[model samples]
Target: MSSPLRLILFDVDGTLADSQGAITGAMAEAFEGAGLPVPPRDAILSIVGLSLPLAMRELAPGQDAATVEALVEGYKSSYMLAREAAGAGHSPLYPGAREALAELNAIPEYLLGVATGKSQRGVEALIAAH
Candidate 1:
């Protein structure tokens, strides 16, 4: 017999959290630091669900492997710095974010977990802060 989707996996950015401002701001910083052009906010936000390297590649086309690696590292560093400056606050949860999570957690049959491309540390920090 097939089992139900007892586990609900949610993506972090733009899904669970309205993190467009923070992520796009950090991307701008990283691009400036790396001497790359900053993409539009929509462009930056569009790659939220992708893996780190893949996101970097998608956002920064024509980027060779090494440049992509550097961009990814730069983004991580910039994001962390921005988050710290912004008090490491919880990213703005979507409209039903808390309610949904609470509702799911309250259920005896459900388990909730995030399945985003963010680093383990980042996701852990987000959950802890939330």
Candidate 2:
């Protein structure tokens, strides 16, 4: 007898891919561009699961929503520039990620899903590369 199909959701940030470099690098650039003091790496990483704007707000307190929005957009711009410069290949898969994906995909009973804090474009780019 076969079991019923089930969804297997995976988080992208640190689960499916190690995007720390692009994330932190872009965030630092954004903070500098916005003239806000950069948050520590630990602090930034702690909010990895939050949406970009919310993460920006937490990372940069005492700032109006407009500034936070600007910072978020600045972060996206910086990340995109860096990604393009690097051929958008920075978010390499973790060990065995592709193999795991393939394995899961091969199983007809499994439905793979990605849940990440990354932007839609970011996710699309990563999927395109992978």
Candidate 3:
């Protein structure tokens, strides 16, 4: 007999919303906050799917590892600040996102939960905003 599956796990970042603009903006703010030169927004966009620290390390290659770590922290700080100031109004759900979720929720056999590297607070905030 096959094991029953009761849940559907979704990847939250790009799968749920287009966060690239906000993410890149926050990265730019982080660079300025850290007194480092801001990298191109297109450069930042290429790293969107990564977790913060790994993206920083990859994007800021040739910087000291410790400094990269600090930059990551700055990025998180800037992101959270921007998030608060933006008041959860940004990060709209992707086209078809709500309709799809509603359709899935209507199915008795389906249960939805996200499997994401985002912190619980961040995920909750995102979902609530949308």
Candidate 4:
């Protein structure tokens, strides 16, 4: 008798990868580039699970569309630059995450996947890095 397939989805940030530094730094740079006061770390972290546009909206409420869009673009640019500069270590996997994933992958009944607010490119980069 064969076991039923089980799907396991893990979040990228704060779960598989410890990306708080990259996230907060990009957010700060984005707000500064947009000439806005940077939100505190906690405030920024509060929107970690949201998409960039939604996150910018939450962080900079009442801002016009153009400003919000610019913040999103700035964040993307800053994050990409940081990632390029730091390479795979920019957002390293959490300790033992790789081994855990490997173990899970080795199980025939378990199918592992990711559920994250990160962009497709970002996810790909993380996967390629580790």
> TM-score, each model?
0.85, 0.93, 0.85, 0.97
For model 2, give the RMSD to the true fold. Answer: 1.4
lDDT of each: 0.81, 0.88, 0.80, 0.95
Ranking by TM-score: 4, 2, 1, 3
How many clashing pairs per prediction, in order?
0, 0, 0, 0
lDDT of 3 by residue, 7-125 (tens): 98887777887777778888888788778888887888788767887888777878887788788888788778877777555566789998999999888778899987677888888
TM-score of 2: 0.93
Give me the candidate number with maximum lDDT. 4
Q: Which ten residues in a row have the lowest lDDT in candidate 4?
A: 86-95
Over 4 Å off in model 2, which ranges?
Answer: 1-3
List CA RMSD, all candidates: 2.9, 1.4, 2.5, 0.8
After superposition, the stretches of candidate 3 with alpha carbons farther than 4 Å from their true spots are 1-6
Q: What is the lDDT of residue 61 in candidate 2?
A: 83
Candidate achieving the largest TM-score: 4
What is the descending lDDT order?
4, 2, 1, 3
